[model samples]
Target: MENGTNTQSEGKDPSGFLSKIIGNPVMVKLNSGVVYKGKYFTRELQSVDGYMNIALEKTEEYVDGTKRRSYGDAFVRGNNVMYISADS
Candidate 1:
């Protein structure tokens, strides 16, 4: 078990899974339940100093399954983010 763990860690890229999705279109959901879609730009696998920076080409603020507003070309701070996934 110990050997397996070590081997897995050694083969893993330090940049992690996020590296595969950089510069791709992604959908980010914030803790407030707001969703944003845009081209991802961050290279860091994890948030930097507890903050994830994202560039948004589109944004949707949701309330009760409805979009309250929409916009384009915005920057989002990480603290509000809940999760991010590659957009199809």
Candidate 2:
């Protein structure tokens, strides 16, 4: 019984994955199929549903005639994220 329950618990809490690399770069994929790579800034683990907020710094390119900079905190839904791994 215990063995079966343990298997079911795998990947149950989204925080577990993020906790491992809290201060490291973790891959974040948006619902729009956009991928972002940046160091872990901060996270809110006290939320009702364990919502993890992460700040990512990455370059942004515009289709206009000029280049611009982009960086900010992204409110990521725990379930929306596909995978999280150390930047390495």
Candidate 3:
């Protein structure tokens, strides 16, 4: 590795299913019964950290099945996230 550059290839799906949903629409459900929707997830994916926390763009927040707010960017804490799926 020269100049701090190692010629290591990244896994095609290093983030597992997340690789499929980077730009697709998604629905994220939280344990508190709150839901967030965004432009996609791999079931549709954004960015997932080791702890499973997610960062999303163009997101909307929902409560009791009603749209409550919107965010240009949003972060979902891993512990609060119940599930994430492609928006269909």
Q: Largest lDDT belongs to which candidate?
A: 3
Cα lDDT for residue 58, model 3? 91
Task: List model 3 lDDT by residue over 1-88, tens digit each.
Answer: 4587744554332364566667778888999999999864333244476667887779999999999999988878888988878786
Per-residue lDDT over 20-57 for candidate 1, one digit per residue giving the tens place of the 0 to 100 score: 78667777888987777776545433443335666655
Tell me the lDDT of model 1 at 24: 74
Give every collision pair in model 3. 21-45, 24-40, 25-39, 25-40, 26-40, 41-44, 41-45, 42-45, 43-85, 43-86
Score candidate 3 by TM-score against the native.
Answer: 0.71
Q: Count the backbone clashes (under 3 Å) in each candidate.
A: 1, 0, 10
Give the Cα lDDT of each candidate: 0.64, 0.53, 0.76
Model 3, residue 73: distance off in Å is 0.6
Q: What TM-score, computed on C-alpha atoms, does each candidate reach?
A: 0.58, 0.54, 0.71
**On lDDT, who's better, 1 or 2?**
1
Candidate 2 per-residue C-alpha lDDT over 1-88 given as tens digits, one digit per residue, 9 for 90 to 100: 2655655566676666666676666666655555556666544433415455455444232223243434555455655655555667
